[model samples]
Target: MATEGSNSPLRFASVEASVPKITIQFCIQCKWNLRAAYYAQELLQTFSTSLGEVSLRPSTGGVFIVTLETFNQHSVLESHTIWDRKRDGGFPETKELKKKVRDIIDPQRDLGHVDGKKSATNPPAHPANAGHTRELKDVAAQVVDGPVKVSKLQDNRPESLGVQLVQAQNSSKSQDKAECEDCK
Candidate 1:
């Protein structure tokens, strides 16, 4: 029901209760724990045939109401359980360490070639590795320390990004619709 390019998704006038239902249940996991609940909300929003939104707070009962594309058609109501806290927690990343490291060398960036890449090469006390001291140090640092951790940001994985999720959701919807037609 969430057709793009709408001013506001219909949440009223019972506009979402009308979308037709398919045979297979859209979601498998029960909305129980925090993760499950969040996941359920994600799935519902992802798969909803009509405009949909989910809201849950610590103050009220932790349940998600899914208003399907029934807005135009049926005026239906569906509820699912949700989580109390987000599984991925921390803060908005105040700084990105990777960008910081990159900035030390390339104030302006490269031409997409490996050789054109600059390094935050440190000066050596004894210039044995002279020209490549910074490169050596950078490699050594990576080996000694590890990859930078995004401790502040929660669930910053590519799959978790909304753009990627929406792309995947669209592909999945097409496939599901195809499969349903094939079955009939």
Candidate 2:
């Protein structure tokens, strides 16, 4: 047994420096706790030194928000809505989530291939978009290389046209579902 004043090895308690905190509020009703926790773990692991804590808060409704706060001050510095079932209709991609968090925590950080522009420019030879990526690249090249003339419509704007198209597609999908159900 070591005595009180024995010549034993001196041991020092490890002290961890506190950094900023990140809070992820996930909706319990929407069953997004696992998704939120996974994101929290990813963020914590990525920014271990820069982050002090990552907390998860269960909320009602369909809210999936990520908030960054100061550890010592306990004040929220920035917040981002990672997902909103009612508003966005679906969950965000992992890359998108990482980009949002990176923007808040470390603005200048590079996410390599996860960045949209980089991936868009150097698209993989996969059937992910069914060659739509090439078409988009061509359109983008055309737009950048020359002055594109926009034909103005008398009663419709581009934004309104997009909204109308989306509404039409949604209505058609609902009709298709109804027709399928009738057939069954």
Candidate 3:
């Protein structure tokens, strides 16, 4: 009973009604079907289990909008606009779109590369390693037992006053002795 001019997508009786739905409306006059379909496929592939359906609705006047709809316990449908071409400035990038959709349906879910660039050289340190700087520990432990020496202030500035750090000479001698004993 569907007509050719109808923009409504086909639905099945077996489809689950509880899961969140995504609707992407693109301008048919602008020939954006492929672009809309691409976004739909990306969303479905990323959130296969969390989303129920991603419908592509045709529209006119250069309209491109993505919306999410969720059903509450009372079965009241709550709709939120994820992207509006006019309001959002233009179509969203693939990663940005995925991030937005993920935030809406499953906020805790991680989209891997879509999440963002991560520095490989300096990965985030664990909380347990916060106070475990070996160099600082070694330097502090080797401090010579003597009166604290305050050097002459530079440029007559109180902030520039330097505190001289003296390392225990006996500490190096003990380390050398230990290395010799290990060799023996």
Candidate 4:
């Protein structure tokens, strides 16, 4: 039996101390703590294990900067500014921020729709379901009567219903075109 007070020979877990650190310095006078906190939450959520620490430093002068610090091959700490409000001309969108961080931590990651392009490697969340095409078309045929409630269309429907709905709606608008090029 193992004693409760005994010093165990093994340590259960360990954390990597060499992971990169992220710092968001926002203007305290401008009350940008919430903005900084939002970015921190996003980064932590997206790269939970990839980051060592995320710090929110209060600053002044309309400053909003995001810096990533990592040790180089030579063991020298190097800091890179990912985003600077003044230099970038404005605040970054959530998707844009995610892409920026993803590029640094995991470049091969697929952000799907956030990447703004549809490729074989990064396909849509839901593809068209041929088996349900007739049902989707029937729903699309309702446009002749009046405007349809797309929100209510997804109830008790397949996960790919939205993609089909968009295609159906668009095709109805332009009968000559059966494809939804802008579905994404």
Best by lDDT: 4
Worst 10 residues of 4 by lDDT: 175-184
Note the clash tally of each candidate: 20, 0, 0, 0
Query: Which is the winner by TM-score between candidate 1 and candidate 3?
Result: 3
Which is the better candidate, 1 or 4, if ranked by TM-score?
A: 4
- Judged by lDDT against the true structure, how good is candidate 4? 0.75
Q: What do the candidate models score in CA lDDT, each in turn?
A: 0.31, 0.61, 0.73, 0.75
Backbone clashes, candidate 4: 0
Once model 2 is optimally superposed onto the true structure by TM-score, how far is the C-alpha of residue 68 displaced, in angstroms? 2.0
TM-scores, all models, native as reference: 0.17, 0.44, 0.53, 0.53
Model 1, CA-based lDDT: 0.31
Model 2 scores worst on lDDT over the 10 consecutive residues at: 163-172
- lDDT, residue 98, model 4: 83
- State the lDDT at 9 in candidate 2: 67
Please tell me which model should have the higher lDDT, number 1 or number 2.
2
The C-alpha stretches of model 3 lying farther than 4 A from their native spots are 1-18, 117-184
lDDT accuracy of residue 44 in candidate 1 = 44
lDDT of 3 at 17: 77
Worst-scoring 10-residue span by lDDT in model 3: 175-184
Candidate 3 residue-wise lDDT at 129: 47
- lDDT per residue as tens, model 2, 24-132: 7777755678998898887776667777788899886567766665422355344455445456656677777777777766779877767744655675676754554
